[model samples]
Target: MGRGVSGATVVMSRNKFIIYIGILGLLIAAGYGVWSTLEVGGELVLSGVVEADDIHVGSKIGGRVLKVAAKEGQGVKAGDILVLLEPYELNASLAESRASLKQAEAKLAELVAGYRKEEIDQAKADWLAGKVQHENAERFRRRMGDLIERELISHQDYDDAKAKAEEAEQRMKSAKERHDLLLAGTRHEEVSQARASVEMARARVEILKTQLDETVIRAPVDAVVEVLDLEPGDLVGAGKPVATLLRTNDLWVRAYLPEKRLGYVQPGLKVKIRVDSFPQKNFSGTVRRVNRQAEFTPRNVQTTEERVLQVFQTEVVIEDPDRLLRPGMNADVFIPKTSS
Candidate 1:
């Protein structure tokens, strides 16, 4: 009877242990199910890097660098001078152009003003001199005519006097024409030509002015200098990059989303961006754009659904990117799903 009771008690203990184990397993399974459901229905997060556009600033004209006002990673505002090129040659050219323009403008003014007082006086004096000579020649020609009629002078003498009078008359006429031209000032065609010359000179000066301004390279946008390729006394070529500036104000997170999740993503959607550099802070962003076409799957997408052969690129522009975010820094973008 004692053996029987001991065996029964042992069997009963084994049954209770099995029941407790089964109940615990069921509870554990139910908890796993709830966790998986939450994971599936939670907000989607994407991994990407902070990126921005880079601008290469340089001079339009090539010359030796005179000064580098900015260093690598220096912040600069738009229109700030980042580099200065030697302006000796360009300045000389500009001065020459300005002188030429001044001369042209003066000529135009002179043409518009007509003749000067001294020039008109000289022209009038020549005309009066020609008139006096013509009058004297006419008197001599009349005397020769009278002598020829009385046979006191030869026909050859009369002809000589006539030729002299005709020559004097022609001289007077030419002098009168010159005086009229002087009084009339410059001709229309001459004035037009002068104006054209002035315009051409003005255009040349403007071009030189632009070139001279280009000698001082300024930042095109608010950015941080990412590269400084030249120092003082270094030669730089035209259109060659002297410095590269990253546009910090236009910062965005470039992330890839699974092709299947593209249907829910739209422009102007709010998102939260996080970076390993600043674990405690979260940056707010907006969905600026989504790629219309699918591309090859990116490595960042790890979900089974995202493991498909295609993914879509998306850009989330940060609202206010301070020093917290940097280009090429790995970032995570979390986008909450909308209720169906």
Candidate 2:
């Protein structure tokens, strides 16, 4: 009977130990669940890739590449020469335009100045000679008319004299008009037309000069050259990209957050960013923007559940001015939930 009692006691002790272990396991699991829920609700982490302003540098006009002043991964400042296009054709066109402009200008100046001293003197002399010829013709016609009336000359002879007199009179009138025109400088309409021509030629010259300047490609902003597609002899068409430049100052990370976490993120919120390249360094950034619409989870999403959940795109701008971060670098962003 005592053996039976000891055996029952051992069975009871084993049962109690098993019960205790079960309770401990339940408590640990419950604690882990609460901690995980709190962590998810209080903070959010998103993965993204770094991005910068990509500027495609190209020519406004087509030409062969003459020289490349920059190379891939080169940092350049605003107004720095990035490439040079063959300016041979442009220069030649410019020279021709300048010559035409000079000619137009000289013509306009001459018109404005009217007739010269020698020209005016010659005109006056021609007018006097025409007047003398007209007077002599008039006298000869009068003599012919008197002779015809007395039957000393035929009707045909008198008609010829009269015709000569009329011609001389017309010549005199033309000479007098020519002299008057020379003394009148230039007419307002003529001067205006000449000035218009000069202006047109001037505009052509200015346009060609501008095109020539465009042959020397310059960086529009301070950036790093990300691509150099042309060499010394490559033919680049008009508006063709010669290089791609990334603005170092405009760096950001393109990240997406779960739709449910939208309320916890907003523009101007402070965040921390980390990159695999610089494991020890954490960069500071501010939420620059958050997309209004929700979309399917991106292909790079880590969790299967996240793939089905709608996500909003978020742009976090890096505050680093030294350009320690580069585009396409995978980054992790951590944002703290703000108390509403």
Candidate 3:
């Protein structure tokens, strides 16, 4: 009886020992399987930050800033009023230029229209009077010639009358020439000169108008105002940066990935993104671009030597960005393998 009891106790002990060993082996295999799943054909996450398109707004002309309509962090659209400059000087210049142009145009019109009607009538009357005097002189000269031939008058007196008749004929010719010129109106050369003057005046007016229109500054694109450099009564110089704007619609993240995974990462590949600011949310995005060249990681990045040894730059663009994501915000991107 004693031997049977001992044998039974031994069998129970062996069974318990075998069961414990089997459980331990299963636990080890499960741990190894979990580790292998984490290591192969998995997603690699890279760190980056959100960025926006940047721009600088400048003034074309120098003037005192009369009003600044935009503030920092303000959203604006194309053609929205951004700034207003002191336009009094520009207005005065434009007015003066317009007046000068009007005067020039008036002068040009007068020149092109030709001589006055009264002046032409006066010339005609002078010509008629001179013709009458010439006819009277010719008749008197003829009579003097006949008297001289008949010996009724001295030769000196006949010569004097002939001279008077010739002088009267010359006066008539001069008066006729004056009448013809006055009736002909303005010459082609004079009209051409007047037209040129009008064109020059118009060009000046147009230049002044362009300058006046530049006084009101408008936004060039749909963006957010990043900076404001001037206020009311502030003097701004030509070519100086008045404000800084950033395009908010096309936001992208700059990241680096291992060169070994270059085949999997390409433009148009879908990606998963997470921002440090929004820990609970995951952003959907795509690989918009990738750099061809490989470069070392920047010294500022906190990465292991293996990761920094060689990496390729990549740009991921977010499809639907909300107010939460902004420029300079830290982000992490997950690039899944083909099998994943």
Candidate 4:
């Protein structure tokens, strides 16, 4: 009876040892399978976040902010008004410049036309009268000189008549010169200078207009407003950042993969992306670019090793982007082999 009990206990111990060995063997096989899968394909994986193109909008001139046309998170199109600076000063400057331009134009026209016809006619008549007076003076001087020779007139009187003839001749000459100058148009140099002045004034007006236009800030591209730093009555200076915008359409994910997997990761290669924010959702994308240089693992990434040892940065362009995959949202990328 004791021998039977000893045989039963031996059988139970042998069976328990066999079961434990089987379980251990199964665990080892499974671990080996997982390691082999990782080694054969170099399944490099990385975590990244979606990011859009960041842009800063600023003013070109300094002035007090008159209006803020955008708010944070507002979608805006190209050329949309984003801000308005106080335009009173610019408008006044423009108006003054335009007035100066008009005045310059009027003066230029007057110079080109020269003296009026009536003024020229009056000058000519004066010249003719002076000529006639000089002729009479000469006759009187000749008559007086003969009288003086015959003692019929005094030498002083003859000398005085001769002086009158000379003075009349000089007056006629001065009158004729004035008439000719009136008939002739403006000098070439004078006309050129006048035209240049007009052009300069016109250019000044245009410059003022440009400055006024700049007071009304507009978006350079389609984007979403990310920041609004100034509102009505706020003062700003040239190149002062008034807002920030993000180009949603230009969004992409930046990821890194192990150097060993570089052969499979090429531009234009298809990829599958899954964002932690939307685990159930899967996104299709293509490799837009792969950095040729290797970099250290980002500080945000954690692995069994303190560093990734070696990795390359890559950009994946989403085929279809939605509002849910916003900038800074963490994502996972799976780059399947060509055969897979």
Task: Report the error of model 3 at residue 145, Å.
Answer: 4.9
Tens-place lDDT digits, model 4, residues 1-340: 9999999999999999999999878645433221111322633455677888888888778799899998999999999999989999888888898999999999899889887899999999999999999999999999998899899988889989999999999999999998888888667788789899999999999888888888988889988999987768888889878889998877788876665667877888887877878899888878899898777644654665534345677898875555666888777777665523
How many times do residue backbones clash in model 3? Answer: 0
lDDT tens digits, residue span 271-310, model 2:
8888889989999989999999776544566876554466
What's the lDDT for all of these models?
0.84, 0.84, 0.81, 0.80
Please give, for residues 1-340, the per-residue lDDT of candidate 1 as tens digits.
Answer: 9999999999999999999999878645433221111113467777788999889888878789899898998999999999998989878988998999999999999999998999999999999999999999999999999999999999999999999999999999999999999998899999999999999999998998898898899999999999997779999998888899999998998877666677667998888887888888889999999899776644565777555546677899986645667788888887776611
What tens digits encode model 3's per-residue C-alpha lDDT throughout 111-177? 7787899999999999999999999999999999999999999999999999999999999999999
74 Cα displacement, candidate 2 (Å): 1.8
Each candidate's root-mean-square deviation in Å? 8.9, 8.3, 11.4, 8.7
User: Which 10 consecutive residues of model 2 have the lowest summed lDDT?
Assistant: 30-39
Candidate 3 deviation (Cα RMSD):
11.4
Clashing pairs in 2: none
RMSD of 4: 8.7
Q: Rank the candidates by TM-score, best first.
A: 1, 2, 4, 3
